[model samples]
Every structure is written in structure tokens, then in C-alpha cells.
Target: MDRYEGFREFVHGRQQALMRSAYLLTGDASQAEDLLQTVLMRTARHWHRLAGDGNPEAYVRRALINEHVSWRRRLRRRPETPTAHPPDRGRDRGDESLHRLALQEALMRLTPRQRAVLVLRYYEDRSVEETAALLGCSAGTVKSQTSHALGRLRVLAPELADLLNAVDPQEVPR
Candidate 1:
């Protein structure tokens, strides 16, 4: 009973953070929900073993990330979001919502690893060392990946690049 109670508390405390990270990784709301559910289920199976650990959250997070990568590799294809032409440059209505959608679409176009790097480094506002640790890579790899992700974003969506430049880094939502 105590173990179950503790697990419940852990879920209540961490569900939002896990969901946010899952959404960033999957890029689709439904898929994100599924991903979180799967991770939670798997974690529950090892709850007894993990619960005694000082930082079970880290272990669960590592599982979440590894599972996400495994799923992508098994599928052998990127997510298949329907693409639509962006609004004409000449007729810019300057709609913030539209810009946000465009930015999201651009993000979805990125490879999973690139998207993960951006989400951890920018959206989550984790330090390079932290991001590298989470991704199981060196700090130098994180730096290079961040640089390349930014460049890819620029090329994939110039308008989004402008939007990114216009917003304060702090204003960027997690």
C-alpha cells in the first residue's frame, strides 16, 4: 500500500513534465499521449525495483527516450503529417496563431533526434551538459547538434526563423 501510494504521488508530481517531453518527442498530441501511456505502463512494471532508487524519475525518463527512439526505428519512417503551403509572403496577415502553427509544422518536419535536441536544449531550457546527458551523447555533440538543428530550422521554414529571432529566448515557451 505504501509503495502504491508513493507511485501515485510520483505520477501526480511528474505527469505534466512527462507529457510535455513526450509531446515534444512525438510532435502529435495523440501520439504523445500514447507514448506517455506506454512509458508509464512500462515503468509501473519495474516500480518496485525503481522506487527504492534515489532518482527513479531519471530512470523512467531514460526509458521514455529510449522507447521513443525504438519506436521510430521500428517504424522506419518519420511521422506523416499532411503538408500545406504556407501563406503567401506578399499577403502576410501577421497572425500570431498562424505563425505558431507554421513553426510547429516546421518542427514536425525535423528528424526525431533533431527535434529531441531542440526540445531539450531550447524548449526545456536544459543546459548543454544536461541535454547531452539525457540524450546519451557528449557535450560537443550536443553543441554541434544544436547548431545544426537551428540551421535546419532556418532552411525548413524561413518565416519561423524570423519569428524565432523576433521573440526573446525567455519568451519561448517550454
Candidate 2:
């Protein structure tokens, strides 16, 4: 296959997983698609370097994470105005959808790093060490971020307390 064909195959193989991670990170399907596109474009520019490495996927993931962090930093510096009217609640139906919306809202209250850490560690089911490596931070930072993120979620959505409390105790580690 030509180099372009090879690169296209590599990106296509990893696109679904990348989109899943992006969705969890952004909590918005549209934003996640945009983030994935941005990450893929940036990765394509460095495809030669990445292809030489044993794991091009890891490089792309790191680039996505870095871009997300940078984007959050820029957003933090800007003053955001609240919407005059709340989003339409008509679209939200059933208990499951409400719970998901609550979870998304709680997640939005966290810092970008904390959100990333939680998504990597819990949603992606990565070990703390692995999450730390992906984030280029210490394992302790991952633990702390997870703790803080969970705390924030609990505070922001007390209803979630029941959901967490309902977990089977035997399934959770001490």
C-alpha cells in the first residue's frame, strides 16, 4: 500500500475508540466529533514520525489530550455568558436520560485534567499508572484527580449518591 493508504488505514482503525474517548471527555457529540477531527488532522501532519514509532495510536491519544487541555485553558481565560433561556428539557425523557444528563452536568463542573483523568481511569478502564503516563503526570496526580473529580460530581449531583451507593459492595475494592 502507498504511504497515504497506510496512514488512512491506521486512522480508520483507531477512529471509533478515539471518538469514544473524545465523547467522554467533552460530553457533547458534536464537540467530540470536532475534537476528533482536529486531533486526526494534527496527527496526520506527524504521521511519518508516528508511523515510525511502535504505537502511533498512543501518540495520537496524547496529542488529543494535549489539545483538549490547551483548549480548556483558552476557554478558562474567556468570560462566558449564561444563556438567557435554559436548554430545552423536552428532549430529556425517562429516568435513564435524566441520569445521563445529570452525569454530564456533573462532569462539566470538573477541571479538564480531572475530567480527563476520570475518563481515562474509569470510563476507559485504564490503570492509574497507565492514565498517568498518558497524561504525563504522576500516578499520585491521577489518584488525587479521580478523588477530586468524584467529590465534585457527588456534590453537584446529590442524586448520583444513590446510584453510587447502589453499587454492589463486593465488586468494589477497599
lDDT of each: 0.77, 0.80
Against the true structure, candidate 1 reaches a TM-score of 0.78
lDDT of 2 by residue, 1-174 (tens): 345546788877878999999988888888889988998887777777778787888777777788888878888899678999977656568889889889888888888898898788777888888988998989888877877777677789998888755534443322
- For candidate 2, which ten residues in a row score worst on lDDT? 165-174
- Across residues 45-107, which tens digit of lDDT does each residue of candidate 1 receive? 878788888787877677777888888887777765655975453435568867766777788
On the 0 to 100 scale, the lDDT of residue 14 in model 2 is 79
Q: Model 2 segments beyond 4 Å from truth? A: 1-5, 81-90, 165-174
After TM-score superposition, what is the CA distance of residue 3 in candidate 1 from its true location, in Å?
4.6
Best by lDDT: 2
CA shift at 79, candidate 1, in angstroms? 9.3
Superposing all C-alpha atoms, what RMSD in Å does each candidate have to the true structure?
6.0, 2.9
